[model samples]
Target chain A: MHPTSDKFIPFITPETRHFWEGTKLGELRIQKCDSCGHKYFPPRPFCPKCSSKDISLVLCSGEAKLYSYVISHLPAPGFKPPFSIAVVELLEGPRLMSNVIGCPQTPSSLLLDMPLAVVYEKLSDEIILPLFKPTEKIV
Target chain B: MKNQKLVVIGAAETTSLGDIPHLSQVQLHADGALNALADAGLKISDVDGIATAGENPITIAQYLGIHPEWIDGTSVGGCSFMMHIRHSLSAITSGLCKTILITHGESGKSRIPPPEWPWPPRPGSYEGQFEAPFGTMGPPDLLTIPFLRYMEDYNITVEDLAMVPVIQREWAALNPKAWFKEPITVQDVLDSKMIAYPFTLFMCCPRTDGGGALVITTEERAKDLPGKEVYVLGAGESGETMLISQMQDFTTSRAFKTSANRAFLEAGIEREDVDHLMLYDAFAHLPIYGLEDLGFCERGEAPNFIRDRNTAPGGRLPVNTNGGGLSYMHSGMYGMYAMQESIRQVRKVAAAQVPDVKISVAHGIGGMFSASGTVIFSNQPN
Candidate 1:
């Protein structure tokens, strides 16, 4: 497993360790409530809806649609400048906010309601960050 | 189901609204509370009920000197004190307690650095540890997300966003208590440095130092004693504060709309019905965003809604008559000042006071977008 320690640190709490580990294996994962079959994000233990502990980890199809995005040009501490942060609505329903790479970083290239697909990169010893590239440009 | 009624009969404020080196946060609160007690013609002991937004040296029950029969510490936003008026109204009518006092103080401006107190934990601390790590630090920056979306979807523009601080400065020109009194123009706002995209330096409220106190009681208690009586006709509170502060989705501010709706409906008023409007301005964009959210205008049209000085001195709603957080003293929080401004308008003593204010709507938002509270003030009850 490659770790991206020099680039950024992944927040590893007891609840989200599995999702991080799955990223290392090149698999996209999400939690589904066993009781109500609800899919959740950022990974959580009990079902937020019913508080039921019954849940299962499932691999999600690495596809989503771009709902919204911001083209930030300022230079921050870790993340690269001129990067675009996006909120991608998974085909499942819940929206995940993350940065989109692999596509040309330009305002015109970043269209609303654009289709996106996720690709995980193992950068270093203990890190795996997901990057989304424009695919299908769902317009 | 009917909601509770709250009325503010007496109040007082500190004139030394700048840094006063010797006074502590408790002392600041004490100064305001003491004046409030005098305004109500009530003693420290007379206020059996005390309410606060957070724990302070002046606890509802342990302020300055005595204890009260009941205590309520409800802190929503700049509207927290106003919300207490709603609470006190119910408590007084329900035979709970009499003479409810709400107080606030912070040596923000006068002191080089302010002092901390043995108070409650900071509200919305989650955003800092979890959300801020990936950006979204302050309200102005975080809120820019929605502003960007508004730019994409509506007529609101960078120039429109500039109007917020421009008007705030105009009001501050009349308000002596305001920290900044210089006359300004929309061009000045456009010329200021950008704190973030679509928002300039003037687009944010200044950090102010001051305290506000309001005495809430029922008609039975108001039969005697001093000062002008300001009645609360409607009040409500709501939030999309749970998972995130700013409405991450940017569709709308459900919390703001929900509370404003209840207050307006209960007060039996419309946007055009009210003569005065006091919307929080911690971020100048707050009113611009709130105006659109509260139905004063169509979605994505906040920029054009406040195009001119119509809502200024002689304009549409006569908003933020006290200079607001931008020009007026913001104190540590915007809610306290909002309450103070409402009372001033009701008393006809505002530096920028408007005429024929039979109805007033005040709005406040906590955290980045934690919770929003609303109160409708009228000359009479519903």
Candidate 2:
């Protein structure tokens, strides 16, 4: 069968299945090192700082801040030109790449250090992505 | 190892610089390896060790039909060549191998088939799971994202960032092999087509097909060769994170700082002692980060230092004299080309030669500030 073009699909792994599941459930999930109390993004089984296998999956506050970003003028498959590709810093002390939707993708509109909240995007039956959006309400 | 002196006996790029559609990727590696061996006045049979990145060392060795005792296929990213240099020093000094050859080549612009990696990565890989869903395809998207945070924190203007390519173009204007040789202005960089925010097309390195190689050996052996010897005084390699967002800080690359510091310490040279510098410029912001992270300037000072013409032509520190990745040719892996320019400067034969360059530093970043390698070359070993 011929596959569809202009679509972004993320692969789910055994270690990361929980992350996709949480996103589909409208929850933002992150990994935490139970030994060191260090929260990290982009799920891995072991702790980055302490190398502790004593890690747990926890629901995040869904709160973040716009740490950095760039509005791409060049077109990418499944993305419109001039959309923000950003790094959002979670309040739990981990940062991840995401898009700032529900706002103009402009430098003036997307201010640095601005408060953000997680919004899930269901790409397919198997994958769900956690995106970000600006918010005035404090967590 | 400290007592043993190591030198680069051979250095050369592919026969042609850019726009070679006929050569396959692996063939490009062979072309560069062959040219570098020729420059050293040696044959492939004369080599006892092989090290390469991008292409597998085993493939490269078998392709050249040389069986070696030491092989390093350390593939991190563009900076893999730098790490290869660091490893080759250890292998040669420890008597593991003599006459080590490090090569690099890529069909970046040609789109040669085979070994093609799918976009968005596979579902199970870390990058595929995290970065790809965000539309981060290549360097322009992912690498340039961090600059805005740096600029905001440092209060640097877009005009200051534009000066990086402008000054490098001045150097490229002197070098005949550079891809973009025309001298441009800050206005011109701003006016060029924008690829990503804070990064115009002029600010990004051009995608072109090219390759370069280096032959390293003991100083005693290099003396027998016809080429001038560029001694490897010190080298360092460091890694941070594969994920760009996981980087400790957006403003500074921890890997860059760690690698550069280790290199400078081992070289026993102060920043002022460096006669020339080659900070890989995959994007305009890279050199800025290099200037500060490498300790050439203080935090939040590189933009102004560059704007003040400190790193430009006739400035105190001559940087990217071979036009760098931005103006010089940027194959997929750029570290080899960066090292070639440093070797040329130390040899006193560079197209845009820095006068009396006794010491030179080549710093490279791999995979979006994820990894770094720094090498120091000198005409004299202390």
Which runs of model 2 end up more than 4 angstroms from their true locations?
Answer: A1-6, A137-139, B114-118
lDDT string for model 1 (B1-382, tens) is 1444456777788647765667766667778888887877888877777877644424535546767776767765456676676667677878788777888776666643444421222322333222433433345455455555655665455777778888777788888777888988888987876565556778777666678787887755676777677788777777675334225446567878888887788777778877888888887667876887787877766666676576787887788888888887776566777877877787788788788777777888776566788887766665
For all the predictions, what are the DockQ values? 0.20, 0.78
Each prediction's whole-model lDDT (CA) = 0.69, 0.89
Which stretches of model 1 miss by more than 4 angstroms? Answer: A1-28, A32-38, A42-88, A97-139, B1-5, B18-21, B56-63, B76-78, B107-130, B243-249
- Per TM-score, the best of the predicted structures is 2
DockQ of 1: 0.20
The residue-by-residue lDDT of candidate 2 on A2-113, one tens digit each, is 2243446776778888888898799888999999998888888999889999999988899999999999887777888898999999998889899999888888889999
CAPRI classification of candidate 2: medium
Name the lDDT of candidate 2. 0.89
Per candidate, the number of residue pairs that clash is 13, 1
